[model samples]
Target: MKRAKLVIGLLGIMLFLAACGNLNSSSMSSSGTNGSKGTQLTGQSTDSNYEGVIENGKYVTSKSRGVSNTQDAGNQLNLKSFEKGLLNVSQQEFSTNKYAFREGQILTKKVVSNWLARESKSNADGLNPKDNGSTSATKRNPIYLQQLEEQDYMIQKNNKLSLGGITIGLGINSVDYYKKTQYGATYETKISKAEAEKQGKAIANKVLMRLRQYDSLKNVPIVIALYRQASDDSLVGGNFFAYSVNKNGTTKVKSWEKLNQKSYVFPIADSQTSPNTNDTTSFDNFKNEVEDFFPNLSGVTAQAQYTNNQLDGMNVNITTQFYSQTEIISFTQFLQTAAQKYLPAKVPIDIQVSSTEGVQSFLSRSENGKKFTTHVFNSY
Candidate 1:
């Protein structure tokens, strides 16, 4: 079979991800003052619109966002739909990596909850009563991580889950409530990409460390990535910050790695009308359909670009490890058919299929006027 080139840099450390159970919850509480400065990342508070600021290694709500009525930004995300969507993806067959994938999903949610709780308690200064006849102040509502879109695993050529690499996408938002009134809700933040990356990495580390508490996951290599939420309904993952734990007996978490993508942005909602050429959302839909049609495949990672809001180029790569030789040929034919059916006819089209042996085949096709050209590389 044709050899495949590995693009992602795998850390030298050995990492494993196992279901976390019966682990000591003591070390898991980074919710303390001396634990993590993440508490300073409190959501909007009740006493004041501003929650707190980080001053000299401390969280102070005295600092403001330069707005008085900034207490409420928008509506709280109804997590019901988000949770249901996540559960749907989780239900899909992830081959040998299903459990770890599921754990990553749950880990992100739990850590967010814990981080918020810790921040609420640390903001005690905001909860103190005033001598001017003011009622006792309540703590700020907790911040949360929302819409964990999907978990992408790094599978080895042996058709086994790679212990050293994993990636998941999610959104960050905060809980805000009225001080005088009792109504409360959560809203997305307007923090810049830099600030969001910083917070995302911090939150990811919190979750990974907790995951490490389990004896099974102690030696496993893992990477957690966080992304800002999208404005639409689809699970279109976007720019992110990756957090990796230190290797070789080191207890420190490494610095965050910022990943930026400049491509056509597409709406999340799936549609049949002229595939949205403005962004890659239509490509994502095609990817979902491919997975649904091919049961032998675990997942498909597809991306595309647009120029002048027109289809410019595209690439669709899928891992087909467990499929037999017969299936691979059929899958290749399916791609050829798909390329002509969905992708722009005039643009260069590349569809790559990789297996446990290596890249099994590569099919590229393009058209000029009414004529078409095709190229195929296969190893059997």
Candidate 2:
């Protein structure tokens, strides 16, 4: 259950520029202003029945819901636990640019995580040296202290820039319990959004308050966001509200002006789906085509939500039990080309590949009305 960090590019923009190497130059055919048209993919089908099953327009898989009691008893698909998914760390849409915190998204996550963990421990233990007469602030959480120490060492080792401001994304996990019905059926109980938001804000406030104690932290702006960890493994940003402190040395937190409501759209969420049956029908075909194209894959999970005939985002997660590195790289490139060609220009695409080595995620988005793919984050 190790947590992985995603590096945000400069200007608070999600890592959009890509270096996919000169991978598939000749194999893919460009179809003018749209995406690639013709491409032959090669993969031996692990499931013999799936070989010709998809060709008849049959779907072998169902939409993957994050919550399941029996299907995946161990919760092996949990993205956060494995640090599997790629995050758009430079979520400029969640915070206000009017307030400055050294612009780059790079190691700012360090600042947020360290500051929050320290703050949480201090408040819980009544060790606020400034407020109380306690001489030792050293009794803070060991995890936070370790992280801060590592961050400081890295800064000195690499001559890295000092931590300015940071956008802290907090996913307040909900505790689930089984409730037995009269018919002996059990259902999972999730905490209400209201309660989750309250808890998240309480956590964020503690982080912000402790952050104000340090001279360096006080000067830079801090945006604290609260998101609910959905059953579907998607991080929904701007759930209740996000808070930020001014550039000046002040602990006063104010609400962030901008919120990315579109980020909340998920495949299971009813409101987010397109009313046009054609969109769903078209997407189903696309899903089948992609899965059929990769016959050797152990399994494939694809999710997409369309609004008004436009795609907000499309995610394709695949697990190749065994494959050569060259084949994996070529497969990644092929998928990228397929997405650019088949999907709308504005749609954000996330392509994740999991293999024996680890998980690798590639994110793409539309920047300045131009399609841009995020640099791949390697889980080395």
Candidate 3:
């Protein structure tokens, strides 16, 4: 077996070297932003184009784009949740069938940083409230807006892609965490839900007005979603509570719609039972079945998404002590069977099986689908 592994590694290296010969033949295109042009290697996907700097001839990344000057208050979980949730919301207004998705290019880091700063003598264009001298949480105005994200939607017309719409996500802090001095203890200023929504809408209006100043964005419809960020200590990120859209030629947001979306960790405490008891019961049965079969399993956990008080989707993670390829494959097959029998059939389900070596297998089923697609990674 050791000799076979050595042969396989050598063959892999040979194949990699052979593929390098085609590097010069790979086509490259020009991607322009504002007035500056950047090189974009022809990507494999024809569905949409990326907006960030190209990397490694095959990937696009934002690292070279620079970071926002605003102070970050949320963790990685919050950032991921905030961005993913915003994209989901945008899809409803800008359907994938009609519009091509693109990362935001209109709001540069410098522009976003300026908008997040407080209004002052030199920074008169700042969107945040002017800071008072007081250090008291209640007396001093808090930084309600933490981050801003923009997504652009493009439509192809006569072989050219043109901007069709824009979606903006506002991440508002629920609790402002700050300290008075370098060595002082941190304090929390909690903002009520109602207050956050109110301030978010006001900020959205201001953002819309500011965006309208640009000639290219004057006639494009814009969708704005307000997200209430979770506290600094929270394990799960916050949710988007409300959203509004401004139609073309409009500079003000007139109406808003409330979103009743929530996410819960599996096996929730009895005191904090979810309103959808059926999903909770189903997930509990599935967890029990898998654990009963694999006694040496580390744990099985799930993050369930609920929309309008109904189960929408779920992502389950299973950690195990097994590492052998055959064992991983067997466990994955059994888990798929158990999931189909116990989990909700109408909701999309994604399951990942992992060990100390990282992910070993994946299983997923789309909404209302009866079959699950399974894949077990090759252990080299």
Worst 10 residues of 3 by lDDT: 1-10
Native-to-model Cα distance after best TM-score fit, residue 192 in candidate 2, in Å: 1.3
- 10-86 in candidate 3: lDDT tens per residue? 11121111111111122323222223233333322222222222323433332214343234434556687887898
- Number of the top-ranking candidate, with TM-score as the measure: 3
Global lDDT of each candidate: 0.41, 0.40, 0.73
RMSD of each: 18.8, 17.4, 8.9
* Residue 337 miss distance in model 3 (angstroms): 1.2
**Model 1, 1-380: lDDT tens per residue?**
11111222122222333312221123222112343533221222111111122323454321111111112343222233233333332223223322222223223433333333324444432211122433223233323354333233322323332333333344554222223435643232244566556566665655566556755456654444454443333233233334343442233467655434323322233443434543344465566667777887855665454434466555667787654766777777777666566555676556677877777766665433212223344455
Sort by TM-score, top down from the best: 3, 2, 1
By summed lDDT, which 10 consecutive residues of candidate 1 come out lowest?
62-71
lDDT of 2 by residue, 1-380 (tens): 11112324422355532221221123321112223233211111211100110111222121222222212432333334222111222234222111111222233443433343323434543211122222232321111111111011001112222443555445553433232336564444355566666655665666667767766666655655554444544443222234343455656555544333233232234555544455455455545666677757765555554333445566666677645655666666776666555544555556677776677545455423344353444445
The candidate with the higher TM-score, 1 or 3, is 3
